[model samples]
Target: MRQDKPELRNLSEPVRFKRALALLLMTLVLPGSAQIVAGSKKAGRYAWRVIAGLVAIVVFLVLLSLVWRSGTINLIVSPTTLRIVQVLLILLAVGWAALFVDAYRLGRPLTLERNHRLTASILDGVLVVLVMTVLIWSSTIVSAQRDFVASVFGNGEKSKADKGRYNVLLLGGDSGANRIGVRPDSLTLASIDAETGRTVLIGLPRNMAKVPFPAGTEMAKQFPNGFEWDGCGHDCYLNGVYTWAMGHKQHFPGVKEPGLVATQQAVEGLTGLKVNYYVLIDIAGFQHLLDAVGGITVDVGKKVPIGGIGGPIKGYIKPGKDQHLDGYHAMWFARSRAGASDYERMTRQKCVMTAMLNQLSPQKVLTKFQGIASASKEVVQTNIPSGELGTFTDLALDSKKLPVSSFSPVPPLIKTGDPDFELIRAKVAEAVGKSEALDKGSDDGDGKKSGTPSSVSPTKKPSTPGKTPSKPSTDVDDVAQVCKA
Candidate 1:
């Protein structure tokens, strides 16, 4: 037989009001706890079971994520998981809101005086609104994540690290109305340690002539000597390989992006580092990413021209300390070649990359998630499997704490016009060797010298002429120091 809690109903106005708040807090913390203590045991036990099941599920997920990081990451990106979570959030919000109302009923609100009813009613209402608002907001963010993942990342095969490092070819594309396909203006091989996320930014000068193609690839057979076909005029340089490959797509049968494939192979051939993946970001769209992050602060060592590469000079990102560049000027700052050497611009680009990588945080991403996600869909294109996002995300967080090293074949070292392939490879090996040494030093200091180890900030100095302390004869270490103004 069911019986009412006469004591609860017979309470004085002050006591009833206090009981109402206590019941509400109990419901907020554990949905069925208040019911078990004061309301129907049958109903409370059922709700208790449901709440217990939910708690167990959450605990299991947390444990799984800690044990199998990649699997948890894959689950997060999976459409099925996202949709299920979305549906569950809606259902939970509805059910929990109902539970709060039931808790109000259990509080015996109607028996209280009018003013007391108003106060308790208002408290219950606020709790319900807060829960619903937060859950709905969460669902919206999850939906955004689903859309972003679906649009940007394909279910491609995962790539493994080569000798404990991922060598990704990052190409800055200049696909304007006047351009044919996407021709690269900046080429860099980002060699990152799989464990520590230590990176070496190997900058390939845009004017670097005679870029090599990997052996046995169709491009190798086509160009025989290098990426230097005589009839193409100035398009024979490394940056022009994309357009040339696009034009000769017939040679790369079944390839969706022959240009990208050719450029990857060329980088592999030049650096002697196997290219695992390629990220092509259209420089024109690069502005949105910066804008999304509220722009980056840089030390402008020299005047960077805007819209005057081969036309009339419209403006200049004048020399200054702590210069904040919006998307528009940031784009020009990275791509501007007017009154600046190609190498100088590459140095500036490095500074920007370092800044973006370090300054971006999980909190910032969450706050400006919509803008960043929208920008990424438009500006970034890559073959990296979405499943590996967790691994890379972890690495990026780790990388923020370390200094970034760079190697560029400029004057006094290997001239861009006639780069010595052997010398370029040798210098690459030396720079990588230095990074390895740095890893060893760090490990020794941190008390883990046994393991074979591998592995950016905004606005710290800008080297003169945008020249990183990189002498043609010497490698540059910690680009942030070189560019922090």
Candidate 2:
């Protein structure tokens, strides 16, 4: 009888192995399922309830987003909510890992044959890793959001859109150790239509001086005529406004970011457009961000010198049809002003922006998510509130489908040393009007006239009465065509 019992138990080894595999698979598919079927029913029930509750909460949030978009955004961006969620995610990860290990123990993996026991252990390890990985990732994202909101947003008064348009000031500059202070070398105002997402990039020269400030502001009072007030020297250029303001921060009482505030006021006064927000990009950090995204492809129309002007000359980005540039080269490509004019550099910068917008596809972003996120945090500093991110994200998606046009208030258009503010305003209005007209024509489906406005192309030449002349090219260009690699 004893010999028969030993044989029976040995014969059931295969059955035990099959049961263990089944429980592991069940746990993988549905947390706590395996324990309920073969392990501690109490522990399994608790875990299952938690899992179901989480799913329900997620569904609720989704429904809330659909019903109340703004409210949902505000709730999600709330700092308190983010911290709580982060803690919850960490707890969930620990709990899920424990449940996975408990499930393996409940399977009685130790009782199985040596091979089966090893297999079970490996499976259990994989399950724990996957579960913990997901939870940890979620926690990380929540923490990032919290940091982003805290760092970039302000409690100050928010500006409203004017005439259904939001004009955002995008400043690209350097704060290198070799440099003085924050000099906004590249200044552009992105004027976006609220309804259609139609956008126009208005580029201003860094050497532009005699910049005016909005009336009634402290800066305006000081520089009523222009920024060329007494005590200001050759450094009174538009780019130096930030540095000047920072040096005299006490002049602008109660202003937290005096330099940015002063710059925003100047932009508004210069373009005759209400500047809602400003985004400052550190040139060095910008290069890091480009590298994080695996570099970008651009069409280099000319040989651009790299590293010059006091610093040792590095090299040159040779002219090419489709040039792939790493961060260092791309930075120099957009910033190099040795042989090329700042206006030309502005065009190249726009091309870089367009290339990134078109080429950095969703798949690439996912693959380089962590690196991109880390670099972006270091690179971008904006006053745009986190609560408004969702709205802007949607707008960005809409803008992607539309054509991007640019206008440079340089040279023939407007003198940099002493700009005609009235003419500058008129030119800005004209450019915006042309963009709006094009959008309207497209919406109305006027096939013959639906194309981009001829006047918007800076390259277009005036047609003669007797014959049609070749269109002259201007600084303004179709971003897509210009960015083609």
Candidate 3:
């Protein structure tokens, strides 16, 4: 009885085709959009597409602004990381657009089934949880980085100094189990004179004679109320002296004991300058820091020998006038005991430190954040507050053009026949800038008296004519006082 309406039937196919294409586009976009419902259900669903277009414009503007500003966003952070994050945001945006369209098209509920809303909600919640977790971790790392920077720049007496004036105590150690509680292998006092724009590094010999604590300190006076070292003939190691000097033993548990105080006093008496601050770095850290800044280039004076029982682990570093050294080989070369003298080691250390200074380029600074962080975190232990840390970082970053001079105390301060105490005092006074008649007592522009030993103190034992040299002083016992000063 009923005949098919040919016109109506013919129109259905093209309409279905259009709807299918639109649905496909919506599917592609809605997973990243917020849901929206309005207008004629079918026609209004396109509203999400319009919203997405607007969102795309906003994001474009933001990115353009970031590029224009040229901050860490443009220079420091990894481009690949930025790209991935951007892509995710784009995908999420697209997903939301699709979600919005689907919501609009579906009317009351956003699902194929009548009661599938709960499942959809669960999936959305899961996605949110994942996204938030990632954001949290990202935020934590970013904040940590910011905090580190802040620590370096914050204002405080400890951090206040002219742009060019600064001091750093450099400590080198074997860090081996046997070497534990022993003397540090190398010690250098580095000073940047703002007036002259020159850097001076004075390397100290490990066997320098000194007491661990001075007469007044309670610890020194109380030892056995102490017995004579002549009985044992055992000299305290340099590191032990530093430990006692800083009073680290009393404040930091397990570091306190008898011998440590003696070590502190010895270093003080030798240097004639109060030690303000120190940074202790081991062989591993030195190598890692070098690699972090890319390999360093050093001028090898001659073929440095390697390998021997008494020498630092053996290997031959070919003689060369100049060469690029990677971390591992560099360490071997720096700690090489081939010549077996502190002077030889000091020369190597200078070459390496100088090379490292030259290689600390801005390109590396921005690109090697992870490596730098790893290196610094592992090796650098200091009481310098976070605020002052930022200032020092800025200074170091700007110190590329500064002229640096390095010397071992042998010729002038530690000649073979020089009295041991005089050598120690001369070197300390030299490093403290008091030995220079002109610079004596002059304010370093910071209300405090110039050449005042920051906080380092030393004590020394009487020299035994023929016995092995006494151990260096330990300052760890006075650590809190020194740091506070």
> Model 3 TM-score?
0.54
Score candidate 1 by lDDT. Answer: 0.80
Off by over 4 Å in 2: 1-11, 61-74, 230-233, 361-367, 441-476
Q: Please, what is the TM-score per model?
A: 0.89, 0.86, 0.54
Worst 10-residue lDDT window, candidate 2: 463-472
What are the per-residue Cα lDDT tens digits for candidate 3 across 1-485? 43324643454544533433344344334432222222245434465565577689668757864554223233323334444554555555445444544433432232234334444444444444554555554544444455433332222236333333555667775656665443467777666553433455666666543333455665455332232244323333344455443544454345433333343344444454444445667775677877777776665545666655564535577755447777777877777765556566765676567667767776776667656766766666554444344344444554556544443446344542233555455554544343222333344554433454434322223322221111222211111111110
Among the numbered candidates, top lDDT falls to: 1
**Which candidate do you rate higher for TM-score, 1 or 3?**
1
Per-candidate local distance difference test? 0.80, 0.76, 0.48
Candidate 2 lDDT at 199 equals 81
| Candidate 3 off by > 4 Å | 1-165, 194-197, 211-228, 231-240, 243-268, 311-313, 411-485
lDDT of 2 by residue, 9-51 (tens): 5657788777777777887788888888766788889988988
TM-score of 2: 0.86
